[model samples]
Target chain A: MTVQDVYLLSPEISLVGLALLVMAMDLFVKRKAVLFLMAVVGLALPVALSVMLWMDVQAEPGGRLVGVYGALTVDKFALFFKFLVLGSAALLLAASLDYAKRLTRLQGEFVGLILLSATGMTLLAAATELISIYVSLELTALPLIAMCAFLGSSRSGEAGLKFLILSGLSSALLLYGMTLVYGFTGSTYLTEIGEAMKNPLDPSVPFGGLVILVGVVLMVAGFGFKISSVPFQMWVPDVYQGAPTPVVAFLSVASKAAGFAVLLRVFYVAFPSLEMDWALLFAVLAAISMTFGNLVAMVQTNVKRLLGYSSIAHAGYLMVGLAAVASRIPNGGETSALGSLLFYLGAYTVTNLAAFFAIIGIANKIGGHKIDDFAGMAKRSPLLAAGLTVALVSLIGIPPTGLFIGKIFLFSAAVESDLAWLAVVGVVNSVVSAYYYLKVARLMYMAEPASDEETPASSISLRLALIVSALAVVAVGVAPRILTWATDAAASPLLP
Target chain B: MDLEKFLILSAVLFCIGIYGVLARRNAITVFMSLELMFTAVTLAAVAMSRYVASRQVLANPGDASEAVLQTLLTGQVFALFIIVVAAAEIALGLGIVIAFYRSRETVDISQANLMSR
Candidate 1:
């Protein structure tokens, strides 16, 4: 590979270097806090590298840099996700520092695993080849599996084992589908695959068009597990109930972001011509994920498990955007659909982090993660309770929150795409979701305080992480122009 | 040596692997089934590389650019990658299973149902 190709991968490489450095420092440092501070500060390297790369790509003629034998594409879209993953990573580390102390003996491995997974996610955003995508996906998952089970409890071990087996199965299925696609199209490059699929093939031939169809469906099924959509979402609740809160936050946000990034890239780049077909498929899945997620989430007692199901509902909403984007295939509606998807991703990322950050602090103090355990939370810890209230309201897509505006944009896009029925389903599901989301908030505010003892002061870093993320959630909702502008620009390449 | 036959065999193996993963109670057996699925994928890729891709290259010999030929043979490279990744996954899976066994003293996944509620 040329120097420029390596340049394209500089952000991921630097991040991996930081992870290694953090892990190495774990061996030498007397104060474990140094590793945390160093890991947080070391992120500056990757951040700078990505911003520089973004500028270089912007200055290029096409505003894109295809490098490393066309396996990676550096552009606004990839840069957008890179920023999302990296920024959330910094916040995740900051927010979870005290919580990570639980893994006292393995603190180094803990932070190192997070950074390593973040590297995979950043790489995922830029991957444009089938092989690169698969490699990056595994790289993202492997660390997470270790982190999931790193707690060494029976529940933690179960989470790790389930995650490992299910994730491996999904990857193998993905590989098998990739083989089928490769066999059908005779290429591994997204652009080339798209070019090959431009023409409708004869269904009469032996493997014919059916091969590509099967390949696409199987690939979607594999990724469905990553995104935690229906039929593939069985593992989420169980895993979330058992895994550490910080890892769950990272998994629910950055990992899902990367999954959607690749899904969008692959579908938009390779299967644009078949949008109507895949779009209908996504629309159906969106409906199922939203409905089932909300309905089942209503029954969950564990806060993490409830959030798990809620995240599934959110996946459905985002897919509504993806499916609606397909409806624009004929008219090529500007960036309304994909733009909403991107904006909602940014919104969901910040808001979920805020909620989970607060949970990490409060749950650490509460000694349990049950919904009932949150009773009198507001009386005990006003700051954390306030943060949770704002986050839960935002999750329900309430007014003056990022998700409210995001839902508006998404529904309008669905309407624009002539998928008004999907929009209707989305609106109905939002109302249904509000019932459960508010249940948690109401419990915190109204339920009797469980013996109002002196409230323990949470670490400053956790509060900062929670406050910043919560404020960003409200800030974006109140004045969404910046996020909208950023997301619109980020979504531009796919629309064009 | 027909590509179709190879594809059918891989597909059958993949189905069997999925079934085993779903039906097996032992985590190790489930993991082995997952490995079988990866093996099926490997076979599919190699067979595709041999029967589909090489045939395409040979059918249009003079027009093939070196870069283009490499892309055509990407299936083989993909197979190589799958093997390596699958191995890494197996190592990690076994480690996770060992962790699971240590906690509950059994590899039975059904017994690892602490959060099944």
Candidate 2:
């Protein structure tokens, strides 16, 4: 490969290198501050790399190279996700430093794995070939499985094991489907499959589109598990409950966004013709995931599990955008709906992350993660309470919140696609979501504190992350033009 | 000895693997069942590759084409990929099992409910 080809993949290369550097420093260094410094630098470097790569992608039209012979991709869609993934990692790292020192000692490895997983997620968005996507997806999953168990003695281990087995099963199913698709198309390159599928009416092709459709369904199911959509989301609550708050937050926002990013790319580029099949599937998955998640979340006493169900509900809402992209809009046309969906994903990620940051800070202070533990939080810590309220209100799709705008865009997309019933179901679920979010808010504001012993103090770094995320949530909510532009730029798949 | 027979065998194996994964109680055994499913996919992929290659050879006799060789190679490469992934899965899968075993003193998933509400 040429030097330029190598340069195109530098963001991923740098992340791998940075992960190793942190690990090596962990081995040699004994000082906590040194390790903390390494992690902060490690986290900051990716953001710099992402910005450089984004500029590279924008400056050089068609600069992306299909290195390793059509497997890896270096494209605008990849760059967009790389930026978001890296940004999320940075936020998690910033908050995690304090949590790590207080809760656990393996700060170096924990931060390193999060960065590595972020790298894997970036590749998942960029992968143009099936095998590359499969490997990268595993790369993403393995770290998360390990991270879930990193708490040493918590239920995180059990949750991690369950996640591993179920996710592995999904991977096997996905691989079989991919192999079947390769058999039918004679090539694993998505564009080649698109071309092969163009002559959908050709009878000479051995298995009718039925087999290929099955493959697509399996692939979508695999992705659905990652995004915590219905029928594939049984693992979410357990995993979230077991994992540390920061890791849970990472999984809910960044990992979920990465899954959606790939889903958008695969359907929009590789299987646009098969939209008639998958659109209906997504529509149902969307409705079930959102409604069930919201309803189940209403009764959750554990804050982590409640957020887990809320994550699932948000996944359902995101799928509305996916359905809109996959379905044909009446008067608004096709790609326009897709652009809106992308915008919504970006907005949703920021808002979700903001909510989780507040939770993590609260959990750290109170020495508990239960919803009941949050009673009289507004009186105890007004700043955190205010931040969390913003997050919860945003999550409930209240006006003047990012999630409200995201829901608006998603519903409009669905309506434009003549999916009024789907949009209506989504709205109902939004109402359902409001109850759980308000439950937490009510505990903080209305309920009297049990005792002075129940109250907890917050840390400075954790406070900073909460404030930053809260500001981001409001900023994105109030002025969505920035996200809209970024999402619009990323709507078109970076084809090789 | 034709490719179709191999594919049929793989399909049957795949079904059996699924049954084992669903029915088995031991975490290790369930993980092994998952490996069986992966191997079945490898068998199907190789068989399909052979079918495609032989068809190409018969249609263009005496060519011994590089393109056909690459087509077969894709199957072999993917098979290798599956094998590597299965190994990694086993490594992680067993690690968690060992960790859980240390705490619960049981390999059966039913007894490992210390975390479950």
Candidate 3:
């Protein structure tokens, strides 16, 4: 509402403007390459603005800024995700050039929708109130649903429809839960709800404790769908396999990251009073997701479907950090659980983007989704094959990869929080996951080509994206201090 | 009507909506059920807002009247947002369904198993 608030929201505003600009330009322009360049170039403004906001947050003594009547907050936490979302959008756009070109008539809309979704994601991280969070979440998802069906294939249609129905159902569940919390607390603000729940306004409101408990549980279920955790993960393989490869990559990383961003904010900010029970609940969900995702992934022949299952497994690993956050609440020492969660998300984003970009490259060339299609890939395109191999290795948590370091921090957080059993589950699941991931690597290196023809080379933009993401993965793996510091700063506002 | 009666009605509607979503085969029918669920949420939100308003009046008469109104308005605002979002969701849902129907000549979800393992 104030001038300063406008300044604080500049990053999101610029993204929206960019989306509208891209759509408007689509009508005037015929060249898809020009539009892609415009989108990629426009993304730089938001990244720069987010970094400025980071400086602003640091300048402030408390390391936080609340704006727009307390509906949005700008802190290291928000800034961290703003950078991640913007970075992912740029990378995805770069990787999607070829895919978008194939759509022909819908290329403009594809790029425009991605920008719109990225705007939603950036806002979702900054939202501090429940209403704002819900609105931003819907904004994040609707375009993605549209994008899921962009291919016009029967499979794409199925993916879009399934995503729509399940997402709608989850939104309803989440809304009902929010309504219950509002009804009981007389507020829609997360901090207000937290304060209200700390001491009941009126204890005679029927089954007060039970009602709040149910509300929290339903909200968890709603968010569970977003992050693709167990029991709500049925849509993952289907949607991932059927949606455009770039869109799947976007969903697997950015969408899940935004989901966790909001999840952490809501649970830590609104439901801290219920930490013990929710923490335990997340711990159980974490174990199930890892075990189920890894085991199911082992049998998948479709490379996309395999990544889908692997993403679910990664979600399980992330949930272990969530559970640790809960268990550590009582002792309240160093809240590394949340810091580790943020760090892991950052690392996973880079690593998964690398893997998905490689898939996009290979799929665009070979025009196949089966893992066997990747046999002899190294001979055809060494850069892509090596990039994917490194990415898959990172995913398996091997040394000198971003995910390896991420897993170390996550499991250590679990152990520090006295959830050693959860850490053990995570370790076992990671080992189990290595089997399928290595299988893909083996196909790329050791197996014979399914055909005599060499696979076509990837586009220059895609190769650039692959290399950048891969380098980031290795950089973060070798030297995690920078990201760790950022994650720590991001996590501080959420912890007490 | 009492608050409990309104809540009970909303709960019944919600359960029916859930049953429809789970049991319905047609895409359009499933979408209708999703709308039904949103309606249930709207009803509950309104009833809860009224209940909270009454409780506020009873707890502190005349002094905190503005606070009571503000609290009631928040719930109504939530319901309003839900309604708008539900409309958007259904629009997109039906569009996707139409697209699916065009490709497959059917809307029965049981038959839409092209991606199933």
Model 1 segments beyond 4 Å from truth? A200-205
- Score residue A486 of candidate 3 by CA lDDT: 88
TM-score of each: 0.98, 0.94, 0.98
Question: Which of the CAPRI classes, incorrect, acceptable, medium or high, describes model 1?
Answer: high
The local lDDT score (0 to 100) that residue A1 gets in candidate 2 is: 66
Over A1-496, each residue of candidate 3 has an lDDT whose tens digit, in order, gives 8998999999999999999999999999988888889999999999999988998888998888899978898889889999999999999999888778778799988989999999999999989887888899999999999989988889999999999999999998998888888888878888888898788546667666777887888888899999999999999999999999999999999999999999988887787876347667889999999999999999999999999999999999999999988777666754578899999999999999999999998887789899988998887788989999999999999999999999999999999887899999999999999999999999889988777775466789999999999999999999999689889888887643
Residue range A65-166, candidate 2, lDDT tens digits: 456666667666777788788877777777666667744567778878887898899889888787788888999988888887777663767887788888
Assess each prediction's global lDDT (C-alpha) against the native: 0.89, 0.78, 0.89
For model 1, how does the per-residue alpha-carbon lDDT over A1-496 read when each residue is reduced to its tens digit? 8999888888888898899988898899978878888888889889999999878877887878999988899889999999999999999999888888788799998989999999999989889999999999999999999999988999999999989988988898788889999887788989988998887674633587777788888898889999999889988998999999999999999999999999989988888876447678889999999999999999888999999999999999999998987777656764668888999999999999999999998897787898888998998999999999999999989988989998999889888887899999999999999999999999999999876666568999999999999999999999999798888778876522
DockQ of predicted model 2: 0.56
User: Judged by TM-score relative to the true structure, which candidate is superior, 1 or 2?
Assistant: 1
lDDT assessment of candidate 1: 0.89
Docking class of 2: medium
Name every residue pair that clashes in candidate 3.
Answer: none
TM-score of chain A of each: 0.98, 0.94, 0.98
Better of 2 and 3 by lDDT: 3
Tens-digit lDDT string for candidate 3 (B1-117):
777787778778988999999899999999999999999999989988888777767777776566566775777887889899889999999899998998899999987799957
DockQ: the better of candidates 1 and 3: 1
In model 2, what are the clashing residue pairs, if there are any?
Answer: none
Q: How close is candidate 2 to the true structure, as a TM-score?
A: 0.94
